[model samples]
Target: MLEVKLHDIGEGMTEGEIIHYLVKPGERVIADQPLVEVQTDKMVAELPSPGAGTIKEIIISTGTTVAVGTTLLYIEGEGSLEPVSEGKASETPKEEVPVLLKEKNEFVSSFNRVLATPYTRKIARDHHINIEDVTPSDPSGRVTEEDVYRFMKGEQLAENEAVSTIVEPEVLAKPISPDEIPFRGIRKQIAKKMTKSLFTIPHVTHFDEVNMTNLLKLREELKKEGVHVSVPAFFMKALVFALKDFPVFNAELDEENDRILLKKEYHLGIAVDTKEGLIVPVIHHADKKSIQQIHDEMKCLNEKARDGKLAAADIQNSTFTVSNVGPLGSTGATPIINYPETALIAFHKTKKVPIVTENDEIIIGHVMTLSMSFDHRVADGATAVAFTNRFASLIEQPNKLMLEMI
Candidate 1:
């Protein structure tokens, strides 16, 4: 019998809820075929079968939260399981690690088990250190937290590392509540990522409003031609056109060496707000799509996202992102740059604002703001401003909608 354990479906993800099982007991499954659907904090993901076999048992049920090493199913196979060697993509169950470590020493339990966590083990392996060599000082013979930490700091570990001999000073023994509450669900994930990005990359936001009356009129014209379009669809079309003239805004930041990577194609990420959280699905090759095509795509995506049918692939890989808060009557607000991407444009609610024509005649016209936030490391203030200006010009002139056709 082959036990199928939960694997890390994504980077930085440690747990997932078993949302569904595609197969039942005694079902014959093919290799690489989907076995179950797991919902992480981000999206619902499908887990594929490891090999062709008949499922013998289903261990975890729907709505059950399982960690990386938790076994979810067992399969009866014809061949015996072979031990995976180094350089193999296959991963052994967590149970195998302790069994292997026990062979080296019966006291493998003594070292702080904290270091035995998958992430810590991966970190140790990346650092080219053997976990067995590190000794745990905890009373239960389990590796104490300090042993792993000290090893990471390059402190020499004896043949048998000693657990701490002395207790902590009284000053360190106080129980204190944290000032900031821990975040849960999507908000927490967003908080952690945004904080990391904000600190790692220097960000600057540029705000500018556009006269959207022309675009509004254009949308009406399209509706008359049997095409329904949202303000976001129009914005997506305009942004795609604007990218042709301002490719730098569609670039990414290389933080490790401090450089910018300018991509040739534009894959626009449309931010969709769901009851659970926010998801941005990319419209690949958006620059090549027509206004109506963008409209249809947005409509399809919006419907799928709102209905919770969004697949994992739909929310991944975006060259740039667009956040339209204008529908909520927001005039203007700064948005955080979606990391890796150098910029994201925040759109405000479009409304009729009084404007004086070149003839000096004052009239109420459609006006809106496009707030652009960018990584200063990848783009300076001037580039961001110039890009917004191009987008603004396109929004003010309804005839530019024709530009998408050409």
Candidate 2:
């Protein structure tokens, strides 16, 4: 028997929601053919058949979220099959996987005869609640994520209100528009990240305005000289210098080691809003790249993000992040920091507005507002203010930004 479990495909993927199974039990499939469609926190992936065989049993039902190592299904290879050899399971007989739950039962259960996913069982274990006693709202007797949370709230099992679990993956024929959106895939992943960042980090956001007159003028000048670049690219270059001055803002808190580790390399994460959700693609070592290089690379990353073609490497290891929402027409926003990264800066709407000059004169200038959010535990407000001020100065005088290149 071939025990096919969810493979650890990428960084930070612990579990995935079974979207649908491409193949059904008792169906013969070829090697590498997609067996099941899964939606992880990162992307939608197809778990393929280990070898050509007939799918024996689907352990995890559709719409259930299970941990990485939990078995999804069993496959009977052609002729005599070798047992699973990945771990200690190799020694265990194949009978456990096929017959542990039951022959005719649709819902698979753990050794305790509890119809619950590994994650649901984990929740029960963490709270010291015996999962066997919790009444499943799923008519099939399978426990759900919400059922566990409701139980924690002192909700009674007999009054279970969790959504019905999908027992078979093949019933759903086509995607249909529904009024209520199921918060399971990317949205759920985003909620988890946002909750973790908000609860764990002490957030402090500072708002400031930048004089974009010089930067815009410089962009035009460069364009006239056949050197094309973007305004955000220039802003990113200016931020590199500001980060150099306030290195603490670019540092991550090593909670385990009880120290703040300052990062020397500048890997800037650019947050791009897509149809699915907000995705950040990193520009590694931005400090070493020119304004044109930054512009070109940022464009390429943004395109890939829109098309949903960004790979795992495109989004990892960002020391700091920036959201340029100016084109989207936002005056300011308190952007969330990519967790583990100390700070994130958002550039908002730029408009031709009246400016009060130092010489007591009013002049029309291009101005953009910025919101800088940082982990207050790592840096103080005074430091954040100085950092934004430096960024503003660099934009006010492109020559100083040019000097930063040197």
Candidate 3:
């Protein structure tokens, strides 16, 4: 018999929750066939079988959390003899096995069940309503007190002949006991990294606005040529040039060694917002790619991130990072620096605003705000400001960017 064990999936990953078992006992499976789906701190991954054989026994049931190197199951291999314990099955209760399996299934399903606070449950009980009947609208899948009240009001409206009235805003603000969500998976990982970055790095933010008139015009011209360019693509291209001029921005500070590691290759990490949390996927050799190429790659990465299909390699080894909140309709944000990397750039919404030209004449122009956060330990304020100015210049003078494309 061959023992199948859970292996280490990635760095710092010690354990994983078995979301579901793809194979059952006595089922035949070939090498590389997925045996189970495991949810780690970063993403969900399918663990494959090691060799072709018939599954003999499942040691760990579904929804159970196990550490690395734990034996998950056993497979019958060639020349394997039947265990002597098979004859002693009468000693074990046949009815108990099915009961145990049912219990495990119930445990796994419980994780996805509706969650509500004690106060919210009390409100539902007082109104003689089933808490499970109420739908949760919170992103975290928790049923709030307001949700209970809304359901009760809806039912009242349907029973009475009178017209329905809007729910008062003041009622929604009533205090209630909050549900405590367990810190696990991607959300927990993000908290750990953010805490480390905030406490260890001295972050200084530089805010500036760019007149994106020429940049917008360039994008429109590209669109006419059958090339779709996004706002981030423009900033990515401009960032490449800025990094070349100011190498320090693309470097990491090795505090223990007391030296700066200036990266020769440019791997830009684009921050993607996912339902689970934020994940950054790196674009290898970004400096060598065209703006259109960057846009295409970003789309692919963003899709993978949202679908929880990103591999470990997709999120590692980034020289610099960029995050854009413009798509969410934000005007600006003070972004935190991604750890180890010296700097990060944030992009905000673009709008038409009045600008003063050289002749003191006021004219409307497309404007976007750019925010840069840098590690003071690695670079001073002047260096960060100079890099931002160069980046802004590239957007203002689109002709220079066109020349670089050649």
Candidate 4:
């Protein structure tokens, strides 16, 4: 018997919840075939079979979160499959086979799982109706409330005399209690990470306001030239230039070595607010990428983050991080630094406000608030202030970013 243990999938994942078993006990699977779907803190991933084998025993059930190296299941085989790098393309589950239009019973029998919302499933559960037994009226094979009701109605009819009373009592929705929710997924992992970052790092947050009057005009000009770019992309480019001047902010403290290790490369982590949690996908070399390239990559990463498709490589080795909460209507936030990284910057909502110019004339100007958090042990308040000042200057004069570009 070969043991299939849960390994680190990406971003030093310590544990993951067993989302579902693609293969069941006694089912034969080929090498490299996805045997199970596991939900890590960052993504939903499929674990491939180690070798061609019959699944002997499933030690861990669905929804159980287990640590790295914990045996999940046993395979009765020679175990010939070699492990690849974590989150390799081959590890992803195959694209679902396309199914043509089919009869209701045919569609139900062809798949092991039915597509249904939690509420729909709950309704079925309360009525003692098998979700599987309810034939979907929709072509997508989704079991809806009406479908469940239809199934209940069909079974309840005693020569059409039994109607309202039999259906009404069973259809009464059972409200799920708060205690019923098991705190054991990305939400749990986010809590763990936030706790670690807060307790370990002596956080010092500094606020800064940037005059975005020039940048707004520049963005419009670029858009007219058919060179579309987002404000965050511009901010990222400016951030890279700022990091070049204040390299100390783009560093990790090696506590064991008693030294701050300054990173030469700028792998910028853009914090994306996903449904799962806050997922920070890294742009491998932000300093090297053009504004357009950064924008394109950010779009791709953000989509992948929201869709839960980010790989281990996508979220690792970020020297510095930024959270653009402007679009989300955030005014400002004393954001926590990503652990071990020296600093993180957050861009908040911009408002057109009155500003006194160098000529002492009052004028309407666009201004955005920035909240920067840094590890107090590695850098001082003065250094953090200086860093943000440099960043603000770049944002205030966005044209300078074009000159600083590679």
Best by TM-score: 4
Per-residue CA lDDT of candidate 1, range 258-322, in tens?
A: 77787888889888887556767778888778767888898888877765567666676688999
lDDT of 3 by residue, 234-324 (tens): 7898899999999999999998889999999999999988756788888888889998899899989998887566886787778999999
Worst lDDT run of 10 residues, candidate 4, spans 96-105
lDDT (10s digit) by residue, model 2, range 1-406 = 7889997776567888887676678877666877786766655566777765567899999889899888999887543345444353445567665553353254332224456553455457556677777879989988876787878777434334442343446436557667776677656777888888988899999999888898888888888999988888988898889999989988999999999999999999998887567888899999999988999999999987766567768887789999989898898788888888899999999999999999999999998899999999999999999999998999999999888788
RMSD (Cα, Å) for all candidates, in order, is 16.2, 13.6, 10.5, 8.4
lDDT comparing candidate 3 with the true structure: 0.78
- lDDT of each residue in 63-102, candidate 4, tens digit only: 8888999999887652224433333423434441122122
Which 10-residue span in candidate 1 carries the lowest summed lDDT? 106-115
Two-way lDDT contest, 3 vs 4, winner:
4
The per-model lDDT (C-alpha) reads 0.71, 0.80, 0.78, 0.80
Task: Show where candidate 2 strays beyond 4 Å.
Answer: 48-52, 78-178
Candidate 4 colliding pairs: none
Mark the regions of model 1 whose C-alpha exceeds 4 Å error after superposition: 3-37, 51-74, 78-185
lDDT of 1: 0.71
- Steric collisions counted per model: 14, 0, 0, 0
